[model samples]
Target: MARRGKKKGRPVSGWLVFDKPVGMGSTEAVSKIKWLFKADKAGHAGTLDPLASGMLPIALGEATKTVPYVMDGAKIYRFTIAWGEARSTDDLEGHVTATSDRRPSEADIRALLPDYTGLIMQVPPQFSAVKIAGERAYDIAREGEIVDIPAREVEIGRLDLLDCPDENSAVFEIECGKGTYVRSLARDMGRDLGCHGHIAVLRRVEVDPFVADDLVTLEALEAAAAEARPQGEPGEDGRIVDTRPDKERFAALDALVVDTGAALDCLPEVAVSDDAAQRIRLGNPVIIRGRDAPVEASEAYATARGRLVAIGAVEAGMFKPKRVFTGR
Candidate 1:
């Protein structure tokens, strides 16, 4: 079995899509995986709240450079809302600030959800990580200061009512763009229903190319690591074993780090000859041939001196340096 943090002596590139467990922040998950792989550099594509879980793409090494490519993709979440109550933080973590005797009907919620399905304006919660005046809005709220965060336009591509377990509990799934906040959405939905509501539970179902089905649990990860350890290693008592190291020996370091290039699958591949590859590696601009005329105008194709620049792809036939890998 392979030993983690073995100092393999060279960098490799790849992407690790994590099914982030609830109650753990995205940064914490990244740090843990980084230590497990013994990776020098690693970063996550987006931040998931401790209350939310799912589809956190961890980019290792060179893959970190491609994070911006997937940052704008849509995200899907499955969340539950408790009707007739409002919270200070707009979620279960907050203190209940308001309550009502009225409970919205399932049909009413279904009808109301359609109004939020398309382009909508949502005011972010005051107790949020959004930066205002160079400080987190939540920090200001925690200080008992009343902060008025303005509403911003956000796209809710899809909002489907999945279940209504009771008169006061409703479940729904939403597909939205980068900045959509489920907690805020719940709060606004309460306002729309003429009653109070707050998010009781939230789970990210998908983010672009990743989904919940791909998630690996912490237990599974530990098992994998145990299986990967070298076999027949003597125990403290001189007996051979087929298990992993003690918890104290499990270093909080990444054992397998991947390069950044593997993270961004959007870049078009442009293979170049050995000479041109060397030039491109050295940051020299090379002219590429056989590129389509329309591709020349694409933003992905960086132009220098009226010629396409090589952002990442290589030229196949000649030592041409100017071919744009139009991830097309």
Candidate 2:
């Protein structure tokens, strides 16, 4: 007995807070989830290296528009640094380039925390996604070229030592602004302490509005799909079953998807009139006159009838649509 092929996915929209596991690239994760939900389009807010794991916010359908906001938000990473060896990539996956026997004392590491905090100039690793000469630095490095990535100012809101498991390794957590690399931090900290080191384990604990609380594993999602799927009619041979997303399955998947506006909830919101919402949807700027209007906010989410209409910039009491959300 043979079953029919599955139908092409429909326009599914929302955000999925996926707890990505190690050894999975962000793109691969996105592809897997997209296939599972049969979504029309998908993307991720940030890139989690194959060596690192944790919250990877996947945007489906209309939710993809808010990816930039999530990417620019602050991120929290808890990682372990293995003392004694420095790697070419500043992580476990790369080749060892140097080694040292000395390990920094807890007090010594704590004493230097203030120096790493706030804004500091940090150099990115050679094997990085950073662009140089219109090409990826990692690609150039792979070609056996000397990649010199200059130091740039990055903000580290907090860097605290969590535990000292042993003389060989220590764990720490950090909350940093965009463009900050944990691998570079591990490498530089080791150099400062006279013990060459590299990142051994790295996991992102938080990204702005997203946290561990919202994380759902891929296995769990599969289970949800199976549980939601209605029993299919058995073929004459009883060896085949139809597999297609009915309304019930779509409802089940929708339960897991966060609203498209959830990513932009951090920003102030403005409510517009029915007439104004239509004008804004047409890319026209409208004057929002009300006490609830944002006074100094350069950007905000505009809603009408309790539904997110668009993201817009406000200036002199006028709200101009920047990015509009078209589909549900």
Candidate 3:
């Protein structure tokens, strides 16, 4: 028998702002994009609940290195609180555990927003990805186990009651830091208002450096790929294959993928010399002189000739390459 050949994929790198549809897990979206682009490596900055639909920033190849920075940035979510039933998971997917006939007035909801804003303690829903004893809390819950997720501090920069569509539900937008759960906010708000509620429609509008407007749907990507292909041509096996060359296909895909540097836009940038860039790539720290002497008192990205060189902390005029994008 002939030995099997290795999988063929290119070392594609960049970020794809995916407008993830409902009922699709983050992992599944990444896998589909990976196969679609034939990428050597891929990952997402944050995980969106399968029930939620919105911006899911996917990182391919070298872009994956910058995911942590994006993950730490603030997130914006616009969700609806259905104020009649409180579900076990605090979302539409879970079984209804309690019900109420009362619906809080618009004024009442506005008055309650202040309590959730700024720094507040939030207990994540039981049916969540939170870890407990080296296992997922949701997995434990599925096994008929009780999971008491602790109340952790999360920052909600802004929370506004956007619209109260009807007596059944009200829409709201929240801008929050990492670890804030929209479901918990809805559940807690309902309890405070003397009514039961759960997240009925949840959508993330923004994540760090990306906004909803930048999102590209999977269908759009598939269409672009189809457009890139020439009229069907026969292969050695006498089957029709994509006639577009690999370079053209990759170029078309690249047009949609955001450059890796865009992910570091929030970070202070330092443009280094070719010699300095070389030294940084070789695992050495170069001194930034004069105008570039003191970088911001935070992590910074160093680039050379408009290409990302290294991400590092610049302290006392020394530019150390913490993580270098060498091959790219």
Candidate 4:
């Protein structure tokens, strides 16, 4: 048998709350972090457009398993809708599809808000990630083809007018559930208010258990990596080789990591014994004890000795592992 090759990067795991700047794609940001941290595996919980800037939760190593939880959480976005013109992509990134000399009054915009609130059917923009016959909508749109993207239900918890920066732009803050498209909101609002609209600026401020304040900028991460003193001595070749990410080498970088369990904070936690944790880690169900323990929970996580064991459900006083965790 042939010997397997060693993995390229360190087995680092945690959520890096990145404050992604506009013009940097989410995939590029994740790739940058993976390189700077030298992590073995990395993924982001949500995708932020290059034109959008805000809290982007990135998962490294085992933390990737918890991404779905973060994705399903409610998100808050502060967006500025530029009235008088609708774009092909429904944002400033696309070509102008329609134009209107009329702009909406604050009262008119707020009056339309009531209709958008709660659950409503929404059509994603033509330039979007939605798949059409296995092809992305945006890809087709780039080829000068407009496909009819189906309308689906999305929950808008609240929509508030923050300010009218000017007659051409209106700033709004929206609290929405998963899959809500801010660009669509801008487009729809513009149409309903008798003025064409598109997104001028979009900033995501919150995802459950994460806020913009928790974010570490990419520049800061790079600067920390540059400033980190090499903790290893030079080899016979006079080159430092021990570049593992530990407190001694990249303490500043490592300190920015949020635990994987933190992403599951929105889910109810089921406390289990060390013995139960061991069983859970082995993919076995164990009896969950505690008067406070829920008799049943659709989705929850198990913790033992203050460390994450697995993500699963509590049923009939038992914890059944769905996704197991190997690290804290």
> What is the TM-score (0 to 1) of candidate 2?
0.91
Which tens-of-lDDT digit does each residue in 1-328 have in candidate 2? 7998877666888889998999999999999899888788999998899999998999999888899999998999999999999999999999999988788889988998899999999999999999988889899989988798889999999999999999899999999998999999999999998999899999999888887888888888887777655466778888545475455556766788887887997888989998899999899998887888886578898998777889988988888899887746
Q: Score candidate 3 by TM-score against the native.
A: 0.94
Pairs with steric clashes in candidate 2: none
Better of 1 and 4 by lDDT: 4
Query: TM-score ranking from best to worst?
Result: 3, 4, 2, 1
TM-scores, all candidates, are 0.77, 0.91, 0.94, 0.93
Per-candidate Cα RMSD to the true structure, in Å, reads: 7.5, 3.8, 2.0, 2.1
- 210-233, model 1: which lDDT tens digit per residue? 556556666666655554454677
Off by over 4 Å in 4: 1-6, 228-238, 243-247
Better of 1 and 4 by TM-score: 4
Kindly list the per-residue Cα lDDT of model 4 for residues 29-96, writing each as its tens digit.
99999988878899998889899999899999899999998999999999999999989888888888
* Cα shift from native, residue 55, model 1 (Å): 1.3
Estimate, for each residue in 184-204, the C-alpha lDDT of model 3 and write its tens digit: 998999999989899999999
Instruction: List candidate 3 stretches off by more than 4 Å.
Output: 1-5, 228-232, 239-245, 290-298
Question: How many residue pairs clash in each candidate at the backbone level?
Answer: 27, 0, 0, 0
Shift of residue 85 alpha carbon in model 4, Å: 1.1
Q: After superposition, how far is residue 91 of candidate 2 from its true place, in Å?
A: 0.8
